[model samples]
Target: MEKQLSKKIKELVLGFQINELTEALVYERIATFVKDEKDKQTLLRIAADERCHAEVWKSYTKEAVKPKMGQVRKWTLLARIFGYTFALKKMENGEKGATKAYDEISKEIPEAKKISEDEDRHERELLQILDEERLKYVGSMVLGLSDALVEISGTLAGLTFALQNNKLIALSGLITGISATLSMGSSEYLSAKSDGEEKPFKSALYTGIAYVITVTLMILPYLLLPSSMFMVSLSIMLLTVVLIIAGFSYYVAVAKELSFKKRFIEMAGISLSVSAISFIIGILVKQFLGIDI
Candidate 1:
């Protein structure tokens, strides 16, 4: 007796089949761009699995299906810009959602269960092999980005009202930012040395450089815009802080398999709250001290 698939089952099978083929193309495209031979080979192997999985689905559907080329291109571009690790991990995460559907479908076709298991294994192996230099120095990045968001937000927010002059605000921010960068770099080096970590110099360099770049971005509006727009400059700096937090949080979430929403909310809350408090303090200090510069 030839088993029959209903319209709903046919739709589901075709959808997953297309997804598998799309993933294969994405992996193949990324592998070509990767410089590391070992990483490239691993990606190729994953792509092979994806192709095999699609073929299995094709047997059930009994129709030749093309991949979703749009998805394949989107992921290929993402991998090129953000590194293959992040791209692959994000794809694996998407597969996790599909696993539930596979489980439901397994009742009708036992092969679906096997495919789900293979997906789980792929994710496990992918994580084991996914090694990007950016992820390696995540701690340094967190320190640099976190400190800059907090320190710069508060500094700019307070100085926005305190100084009331864009030139003075910009000058003060640059001076403070430069001094803090030096202090943070030195502290990082000393701390890494104390911990017996490899390449203390590199760690310090990464931290210091990340911090300086962030500070530069935050103070940029103040430098370029007119003095009357100091308030607007502060607003821009605050917006920069949010973007920095969101960007870093998203990268870490994808790379490390963490929660982007939770991390982002916590960081934004803490940094913004500090800025709010410091803003009030700045007003109080300016009024109490009678210092108008």
Candidate 2:
């Protein structure tokens, strides 16, 4: 029974080592394919780190009383067959899951706790790298789109309110929406190119396209509604509420150090403040500038 338990443990260790190697390979491929210089550097660093972890586990496997060499080669080949993109996503999911698994298993296997800690650290590092890389792309895309959507939507809504049933309100909304989409898309594309990072042009272009699409989608309702006393206002309020909820949820998820309630309240407060300020400015521009519908 004792021998069987030792064999089982050795197999588990070898399985984990194979996973580390697979992750290392995935990172290496990502490092090679990534065009952004910063992202490339980060991937290379992570690959190197994973390689070191594989070596550590290799050493442990060799020194163990009952060595169990699992299907490492087979698994590695299978991962390669799946292609780099799928493999990378798998590695990310595996790392995240392993972190939680390690945390749970550490309570029972005190001696293996060190290994678990190492896995946890590596998982965290990988997650951080992913988050940083995503921030560079995702945040910028979302910001450009959300900014245009809210600004244009709010402008059209306010104009409709002040105009008191002018058809020009819908026309202005269309003009602003198109202009904002073009301007924001161009700005995002240029900014991405200007960053001196060699990102996959297709990826960057897609992100820009997504930004434009998001802006257009958000502003479409305003244009679709016929000139009414309150439909535009209702649509604007609904969009604003959706944005607030989505934005607050993102803030809470990413704000690691802050409690959810605290982050929610803070983000909600800031959003409300910004909305109030924009509305007041809109009113003033209409009142003082004497802009005609």
Candidate 3:
């Protein structure tokens, strides 16, 4: 017997069917490129489950719905660029909004509750098995990014107030940043080696790459702005520092299941504090030495 569902309920059920079908395709596509046999099998299983779910919803709708092919491409591309762990976890997080809909649908179709339970189970399994190799070096990345934000931002702030010349500040900053990048990379190498990390060279490389990228972003404002626009360049650089801190914190928070707010506040506070103190120090030093440039 076909049960009568309200128009709104039918629409919601169709939406769920579409989502399941899209995720099924996304997982299937992603599984093809996964190198690890275990991971690929896991993805295949999840994709099968999603397909089954879509079929369940389709039974209620009595009408076939097309999967969102655009979303399938977007997630697969994201997985390629950001790694499967980050992309899949991020996509799963977006599913939280569907919980209430699932609850609503469960009252009409009891099978919806089983699907919800399966989704919960899948999330738990993902958490346990999605540990990628790159995540192991997140500590090295944190070290590089945090140190660059604090040291380079402070250095740039001091130089901006003291030198008052954009080109000169950019040159000095590049020199300092390059030297610090090498030092940080070598230090990470030694530290990782001493700690018996499996791949110390890779750890150092991650650290160096993170540091150099941060340095480039921080220094680009001064290099691009006019020589007389020191204050504007300084403002833009500071904003970029805040953006970098927020972005990395959010990335780590999502990937590691950590607290985004706490991480962002801690890092931004430390970096900005150092910049402020250095800015004041620059004024003091310039005035005391009577240096005009």
Local distance difference test, per candidate?
0.86, 0.55, 0.91
Stronger candidate by TM-score (1 vs 3): 3
The sequence of per-residue lDDT tens digits that candidate 2 reaches over residues 1-293 is: 22222555556666666766666665665566555677567667777776676676566576423212243344345344533333344445445555554544445445566866766676566545443344345546545545654565456556654564435665676677667766666666677678765674544554556555654555455556665644555456546645654653444244222355654555445544555665566677778988755
* Clash number for each model: 0, 1, 0
Number of backbone clashes in candidate 2: 1
lDDT of 1 by residue, 197-229 (tens): 888888888899889999999999999999989
The C-alpha stretches of model 3 lying farther than 4 A from their native spots are none
Best-fitting candidate, scored by TM-score = 3
Give the residue spans of candidate 1 off by over 4 A: 35-38, 99-104
Score residue 181 of candidate 3 by CA lDDT: 98
Report the candidate with higher TM-score, 2 versus 3: 3
For model 3, the run of ten residues with the poorest summed lDDT? 123-132
TM-score of 1: 0.86
The sequence of per-residue lDDT tens digits that candidate 3 reaches over residues 1-293 is 67888888899999989999998898899989988888788888888888888888888898899999999999999999877778888988898888899888888888887888877787558545865777888999999999999999999999998999999999999999999999999999999999998899999999999999999999999999999999999999999999999999998898888999999999999999999999999899899999999
